[model samples]
Target: MADVQTGTRRAAGPRDTVWREPAGIGQTRRARPEVVRVASKAIRKSAAIVLLLALWEVLPRLEVFDPVFVPPLSENLAAWYDLLLSGQLLEHFQASLTRSLAGFGLAIVLAIPLGLLIGWYTPVADLLMPLLELFRNTSAVALLPVFILVLGLGETSKITFVLYACSWPILLNTVSGVKTVEPLLIKSARSMGLGPIRLFQKVILPAAVPTIFTGVRLAGAYSILVLLFAEMVGAKAGLGYLIQDSQSSFRITDMYAGIITISVLGLLFNLLLLTVERRFSTWRT
Candidate 1:
């Protein structure tokens, strides 16, 4: 009987001592909260968007506002769809995008380097500060006539206006970012015998990146706003022109469609910048 009992008993093994989870249990434990978090955030954003759309759709129908002024959301959507199908929307969008992007790109290329130079050197900042302050304080729109006159009614004028509008925010933010780097960090880097260029590249630039990004985001928003105004003032094919034309023609729905398109485009541009900023800015995390 003892021999038979001993034979039935299992031998002690590594598997017996080790705690083993079922497949996927660990992953589920780790991923579940993240999934829930993302889903909840998405649900909240979607709910807000849906509620706004519902209000937009219902308000005009209720006759509280003039239907002519605030066309039903559905009508605007239908107009947008029609425009899209006819390719008119695409043409205007492409034209606007080209001009806006061209101006924004030029602004970035010019502003960042000049910002760095001004921020790094006291003499340069002193020399440029008064003129910069004057220009920055002046309204971008106020300079529109000057640009149109100098650059003429060509694409160059429109792009130049956008560049001027975008430059101030980027330049200001970059200077602020560079100036705000911790003095202790600079001292520590100097103590380590890091050269000025090396210290700037390794320590200063990294520290300044977040603030610079803030300026870049501001510039991006400014670029779109200025571009729209420039387009509206004088353009044959752009969303601004579309809106102007529709308004003149009393095509309320078409005008709303243009407005909606620009709103969406602005939102998309901000989202794109945010994504890029987050990708490059892991240090903030």
Candidate 2:
């Protein structure tokens, strides 16, 4: 009887041990693979950039490239640091940021509604599409002289040029997004007794958000590109001006620093837009 009781107690102890094991241990084991996968993906994605930067640092030191014409990455970083300390970088960056935000904001305000109207109304599309096609083909940089002639070389011309350059992408994308919404979705909404305004608000707008964001991202890039040209042409202060002045004066390291700064700024801006895009596109997930 004692042996039987001891056997039963031993069996119970094993069962209790199994039951007492933490559920979190299993979850942690499962979660580790996912975390590792994400980390590996990130590393793979960053490999090319890392290689390029490594080459930039190495080739310059090896004298494979003339350091005068193409400075080492370290030299550029030093120059960038010096500029930062002197407050010059901040001043130029502020100037560029203000112009970019102004033109980008104005383009968003002007394009989205206009695009919706043109896309939704047949008559409006018929009247405006041809003109848009014509102007869209014309390069914004080519019209620099015309802008200077009219708006002059001040901030007005630069801002307006940015506006013109940024507007097309946003406008065209908005129009496309609105027009390309699924017909079935529209029909279903209508069948449910949804009014035109409610239909647009709920169905069409949400569906078009991804496409519209694509254009906004493009316009954000263009705002910087067009602004650079505008600044290089006449401006006394800006990243563009900094690069131009540095080059003209043969301060090669400084020029590269400015270029790096512009690249960093664009990268940061793109990341910001991507975050905003993701926020608006959570429904797709």
Candidate 3:
């Protein structure tokens, strides 16, 4: 009878046992699909750029385009590498970056507060709107000569040109952001006994952040574009100067390298702004 009971207990033990996967294994299995999804999305988004680069590489080699005027992408990349090795690339990049950042930063600092003031106060808007409209209608390119004449052909002129170009977008967008805050949000805040300053801090500013960021991104692009033009016209060291100089000297590969560098810089700057925008506006999500 004891042997029979022992045998029965042994048989039941297998059925009573429970099994679980190791925690790491289960987590890895769940994570793989997410990783794959992210990779696939990135690849899809980059497909067009890859196609364009392939065409750039092949077309010149195939003689479809004049190689003298438009060198193969590989040649341009080699030239870029040479420039990097010689430290010329870094020098030019620093010059351009300094001017761009100075102007861009100043514009942001000045425009946002002034924009807030104009947007919030009707009397101020009434006084400034006409002048803003007039200046806003004037092309930055047309005013380039004026800046050069007044500010002179130094760093001041270049940076001021960038500032002038970048400020309009940010200022306009800020004003619009503030004015377009939903009336319902304001009323809700008021009902909660929130004062004007608290209302602005808690409700208005948060609501306006998306619009404000849109302006900031636009200003960022303008900073690069306007600074490039300024550098091309007057600066001794910058990507624009490199491109202009290379083109004049018939160094097609170097010109293309400079052009590519500018494009990459613009892309990277925009990406940075986007990251910041996302951080600030996560409340929307």
Whole-model lDDT, model 3:
0.89
Superposition TM-score, candidate 2 onto the true structure? 0.87
TM-score of 1: 0.86
Residues 1-285 of candidate 2 have per-residue lDDT tens digits of 123222222233645552323445555555657677668878998999999999999998899999889888999999999999999999999999999999999999999899889888889999999999999999999998899999988888989899999999999999999999999999999999999899989988889988888899999999998898889999999999999999999999999999999998999999899889888886653
- TM-scores for every candidate against the unseen true structure: 0.86, 0.87, 0.86
Q: Candidate 1: lDDT over CA atoms?
A: 0.88
Give the alpha carbon lDDT tens digit for every residue of 75-188 in model 3.
Answer: 999999999999999999999999999999999999999898998889999999999999999999999999999989999999999999999999999999999999999999
Query: Can you give the lDDT of residue 146 in candidate 2?
Result: 98
| Structure candidate 2, residue pairs in collision | none
Off by over 4 Å in 3: 1-32
Collision pairs in model 1: none
Write one digit per residue (lDDT tens) for candidate 1, span 125-219: 99999999999999999999999999998899999999999899899989998999999999999999999999999988999898888888888
What lDDT score goes with residue 202 in model 1?
Answer: 95
